[model samples]
Target: MLIQSIIVGLIIAAAVVYGVVTLSRKRSAFSTKPGCGSDCGCNSGGKKLPS
Candidate 1:
């Protein structure tokens, strides 16, 4: 019973760490400067949709 509890605790800790890492990676992936991609059409720093 004690071993099982320990194992479960470790699993929960690992899941929490994984969740934190995943969230951080996702946030960084989307944390980019606007108007920096190919979607911009003019010199102004604004996003432009293709017509």
Candidate 2:
């Protein structure tokens, strides 16, 4: 019984940790600055191209 409880607790903790990490990664991924990278479809160093 105690072992089962411990296992359950561990699973819950792992799930919580996974959730936190996933959310943090998503937040960081969306937190892009101007001209951050090519993924944002903008020029690097925040420079504007000739129109």
Candidate 3:
């Protein structure tokens, strides 16, 4: 019974860590403000950079 509980706890901890890592990676992949990350001829609703 004790061994079973330990295994379950480890599985849950691993899942939580994995989810946190994935979320952070996705956040970084998105552009900071939705424009000009790749210079691929895109328009972000006529938004322009500040001079």
Give the TM-score of each candidate: 0.64, 0.69, 0.59
In candidate 1, list every pair of residues with a backbone clash.
Answer: none
Question: What order do you get sorting by TM-score, best first?
Answer: 2, 1, 3
lDDT of 2: 0.79
lDDT of 2 at 19: 100
Question: What ranges in model 2 sit over 4 Å off?
Answer: 34-43, 48-51
- Candidate 3 lDDT over 1-51, as tens digits, reads 999999999999999999999999898876465555343435655455555
User: Against the true structure, candidate 3 has what lDDT?
Assistant: 0.74
The clash count for each model shown is 0, 0, 0
- Quickly count the clashes in candidate 1: 0
Q: Which should have the higher lDDT, number 2 or number 3?
A: 2
Q: Poorest 10 consecutive residues of model 3 by lDDT?
A: 33-42
Tell me the TM-score of model 2.
0.69
Per-residue lDDT of candidate 2, residues 1-51 (tens digit): 999999999999999999999999999887876656535355566555565
